[model samples]
Target: MRSSSPSPAPPVDLAKARRVAVEAAEAAGDLLRAGMARPLEIRPKGTAGDVVTELDLAAEALILRRLRAVYPGHRVIAEESGVNEGTGTAAGADAGLVWLVDPLDGTNNVAIGMPVYAVGLALCAGPVPVLGVVHDPVTRRTWSAVRGEGARGPDGAPLRLAAAARAGRADNPVLAWTQGHEVGRGDPVVLPLRTAVEARCGRLLQLWAPLVAWVMLARGDIDGIVGYRPELVDLPAGALLAKEAGAEFRALDGGPYEPSIDLPPAERGFVAARPALLERLLETTAQACRPAAAGTGSTGGTEGTGGSAGAGGSGGAAQGGRVRLTR
Candidate 1:
């Protein structure tokens, strides 16, 4: 005789996923570090000066094999190979658990022997990520975060987001900037925003290596990161890490980045920072968002005095089509 009731769904094991991410990233990083000494093929990936090397393919293959072996029912979206769909029960679920992988996040830098590449691996239950891991092969440094459990560093210590922010007493904070290739280098909106932020900051870095920037932000090495229409694959994991470390990750419209569990990825342009800096960041964003007058080229200007960017909420960015995806 067969059982009458259907079997209960297996629980999503985030701890296991986090462990896998760490191992896979480290493994991929080892391969990437080795490949750096003897690289053969490199090709242009996009118009925005992105490149893909043979190392990228090798690392992705290694990661996919490890991930598939463990969670055969999980979907994966890797930078080199694109999306590989899942099978069996988890595939048919409404939320769709997925792994977003950037096998060689700083491929161009690696190709040039800059030694700044990393392996980014993340697991998400729909748009909300359960964990994120970034591993720097050269330095052997790793930053990881488990949602609701807090973020951790390579030394296995919890990140001191607030204490670190307080310790840094620089009048002008250093900031990292990230934008998708689709946003255009000279985009009118981005230009003014850049000009405004750069004018006030001690420095505004455009590393061309965004995952590195994300790690820096999570580690509190930089004050904040401002992004305009960043990539989906790289965004969620980084955001989760930063948020878990007590940073606020939200939209440029002064709104909460309320990700939908069953919907596609939707974290657009954002200001990610500690609480003390959140209001000021949002103020500057609002000031920058104002329409530029005729013929001044939207250059630099006086920054906002400072105020909370609480609860403004993307103001129809969803319904009014203000926020857009990179793809």
Candidate 2:
């Protein structure tokens, strides 16, 4: 095997970082694609909701090793290792750079013969992610974003996302949501997407991983996506990419999702949508979290069911209002 070279030191050149990020993402994506078909050693974690597999661990290790080869000094915040290379993997420091790496976001889907999984990589400077890359190896599509430089397709083909902002509902701006069963207790909003919106135009895709959704949003493939429990590793790159792409992003309840380098997981709550309908969607989700609008228990009340863990139920019944999307 050939020996790997060292990554350039800090005051990271944004351009260089972007190039490295893109290259590394593609390489990591290739590894994932290579391993897709074989039988995977899968196991469960927490409840049935949590899962782990040999592929998940292997992919993460591959990414970590490769990224280190290119940029040894830069810090990393990952799901499996918590934090590494930055301030004892627990504390804060002035590293000024970190790579939020989620080697595989939809491991379950990928493992179970589903095609919705993806590999996500985001580069953050301080608290803001400046570069993002989401790759779907199965489909061979790569989505990327560079802060202030718009998101792009696999071949570096530029997308006109700024113009899409003024697009109307008739345009069928794509909209996505948090993972179906992954929303935590803190997530107070859910989607009851207007069927009219879904029927209007464009495509309706549900790729589970937040990074992939954000990438598609940035690429203008899909118009918008929302997720609450995005950890730092999950959002930084995607956030910068979307912002650079001219897509508006915020907490589903309309709050800031600025990630901290020192924090454990970027505390939940986030949304990304077209400026035209962002506020309205946020309002809709907020309304869904409220007590049933009195006598309106068909969809928004206890009459409704289907919630994951910690969803405010005495017997694990569906809790909260009618925010589950039918479309």
Candidate 3:
């Protein structure tokens, strides 16, 4: 990787792109919803908990078609279908743009008739996510956000948590936990971190469906999210959504989260919460990751906003936001 910060990306018609992404995600979600009640040809993608169904493939194809039809020059990465190098790549070299898609984010839940699932998509300019759209066909709700813009729900209004919801109750905090597929149950770093957080929080939820958990966090239904090396495919969209919804996505070392499509798995985990709850979340994170950071654990390295993280400056508000909303 280059040892220098990336130059600023030129502005584009991101509003139009956001519309296209929202449409694609919703359409794919509709497909998933329609197929949910039917018998699925489910198969293991890898570990026992990870699975894929025919609906996942169908939904991905539906979303990919909508996306390619609009931006054929942009790179497209989908969960089920292979990457479309087209005129761009995830490296953002050709067109300096990439789209990340997870047409059915909760395939395991969907396979088992669980009502929690969503269709997710994101647009990245170089390494930074500029737009994100996540749709839940079951509830017919869609959440979207542009990099500098605030997050929005299906009603097209900014998503703001009530004061009570934003408060992280010291005695009853609820948190969502996410882990990458590669991290085994016995992972040294994850096991310790998970144990620590679980002990403190009144309730700990690990949905395996990260996008769903992200929505819960963004909407302030949960206190925070403690992701232990989440997948890149699901990270860009959900992280953008939460950040725009007046929440912060911070590295375990308390550095600002400047996500890149190129970071190593060890660098991808984070803690997300509204500012009111950030310090507490960070305190928990620091305590949990202290041992891991001393070794070769997933979240060991100190993260810089530039250089290896592929950012030139802070990509957050008021310096980094566009569609600003008062907290």
Candidate 4:
């Protein structure tokens, strides 16, 4: 008997995928908005600075349910749940379609009544993030993107980054940076990098919320963002959003940001900026990683306006704190 030919993979409808991601994100956003009204039940995870709330679990549950309902045989890797193979499907078979969910991106901000938190969801095919959606319940704005389809705003208007050439200029550019929640001031990478960025940029905004930083960059409200030691849950959605919005994304070492669920949390961190500015940003970051100058101090100065982490603000957690829901 002749050997049988292998079957081709099924076609993926990116538009439909984008819609499902938005719907699921918005559904979770509803839960988050409602939960924010009540007194939050917060507890530490991993370390004192890392925290989880009741709303995080509830919002994650809604997101997973909605995503699984729409894509029955897809895999899921959520912040709370770890990993779940699709219904009746083997692990390897469902690897091509995976949903990465962060029900609540900024728990610390939420706990303090700061409206900077959001719901971030992204769909990856094998190792590529093909769809992304981030919903801010407070602002009622939803940002969505499909690979090659471009990013869109809450009003469905096309979102584009500021021109790369203009972004490279040193004139009053606003750059944002975030350190791992558990990382301290003594970290060789954190302090110097902050000092370098502060020295180079006109203004430095330290917001612990990565999703907010990504949204601001996509909307042209910020010039660039550099996140150090970001967790998997915090990187995917924003990476895709920035990529689709004409921004350049790379690991701090100048490599492509891999979208695999199996890769460990980035040690060198990640950088996303307009194409022209990315090279310089990387150069500055690399130089900062070297030995500091004799008189260099850790304090980068509080030149920008934003609440610090001690004042009900968060930078982003090092660990994934969501409750796991086994199917």
Best by TM-score: 3
TM-score of candidate 4 relative to the true fold: 0.81
Q: Which 10 consecutive residues of model 1 have the lowest summed lDDT?
A: 307-316
Candidate 2 overall lDDT versus native: 0.55
The Cα RMSD in angstroms, rounded to one decimal, for candidate 2 relative to the true structure is: 9.9
Model 3, runs deviating above 4 Å: 1-11, 47-49, 87-94, 162-170, 297-327
lDDT at 236 for candidate 2?
A: 60
Off by over 4 Å in 2: 1-10, 86-94, 162-173, 179-206, 255-267, 289-327
Candidate 2 vs 4: which has more lDDT: 4
Q: Clashes in model 3: which pairs? A: 148-322
TM-score per prediction, in order, is: 0.81, 0.71, 0.84, 0.81
Q: Looking at model 2, report the run of 10 residues with the lowest lDDT sum.
A: 310-319
lDDT of 2 by residue, 1-327 (tens): 000122224366767777776677667777778777677776764432555667666777888787777677677766556466643432243366777777777765665677666667777665556677777777877777766566677777875464444345435556765433444333323333223233433554555566666666665667666543333455566666666666665554456544333332223445566566566666654444333223342222222222212211010111222211111
Q: What lDDT would candidate 4 get against the real structure?
A: 0.67
What lDDT would each prediction earn against the true structure? 0.65, 0.55, 0.68, 0.67
Q: Rank the candidates by lDDT, best first.
A: 3, 4, 1, 2
Q: Write the per-residue lDDT of candidate 3 for residues 233-298, one digit (tens) a residue.
A: 777788888877877668876877776666655677688876667777788788878777667544
Give the top-scoring candidate (lDDT). 3
